[model samples]
Target: MGAFDMLSIAGSSMGMHQTWLDSLANNIANVNTVVSTSQTAFQTQTPIVRALAGGGVEVAGLALSDPNGRLVSDPGNPMADADGYVRAPEDDLATQMTSLVMAQRGFQASVQVTKDAQDTYRSALEIGRR
Candidate 1:
């Protein structure tokens, strides 16, 4: 592969990581979302990534957590059912936070790779000029 191919690979990785981060953010944002029994609870969004045969990665699709959420007794909630039951997603905050951290690291690493590749290409140009 050419030296510039590293930049393309890093860019694709960064894009995939960004999508993952977005999904994680959405999941975290809806962590406390509660719905009436008549409605389905919010589902956690997960990005499905796949590797390219040539190089880099891509977001294939999004997978959602189970729709069957746990019931909570919240009689005070306006959306609560007649029995004071509300549906909340079964997503775990710990798991979401962990994924967020990992995705951030992956994005940062990809950015670093892009910078390194640019620096290497620039140094090579300087050597050729010398």
Candidate 2:
């Protein structure tokens, strides 16, 4: 592939990584939300990414959180049902944080690839000056 194609691949990777980071952030933010029932509880989200054969980016889909919500027993909580059980997303903050870190690392890697490719192309131009 040409230098331009390498650039396209890196750009697409960066875009997809951005979406991945956003989804992780949103999931972590909603970890504490309470719902009246498990069925209606907020669900975490994840981004599905696929690479194009030639070049560019394509989002496969958005994966939703698990259907079963975590139950917490707190009689004083207003949202609690008759059994003092409240429904919240089962998503773990720690897991989401870890995912965020991974996404950040991937983003950094893509950026480095792009920068390196750019430098290589720039250096190639020096052939004319020689």
Candidate of highest lDDT: 1
User: lDDT, candidate 2, residue 45?
Assistant: 88
User: Which ranges of candidate 2 are over 4 A from the true structure?
Assistant: 55-57
In order of appearance, the predictions have TM-scores of 0.91, 0.91
Q: Look at candidate 1 and tell me the lDDT of residue 88.
A: 94
- lDDT, candidate 2, residue 27? 90
Model 1 Cα lDDT, one tens digit per residue, 25-99: 989999999999999889998888899998999999999887878899999999998999999988878989999
RMSD of 2: 1.6
Please give the distance, in angstroms, between residue 44's alpha carbon in candidate 1 and its true position after superposition: 1.1
Cα lDDT tens digits for candidate 2, 12-129: 9999999999888889889888866534777888888877989867678898877667887877888888898888887888888999999999999999999998898889889767
Compared with the true structure, all predictions reach lDDT values of: 0.93, 0.85
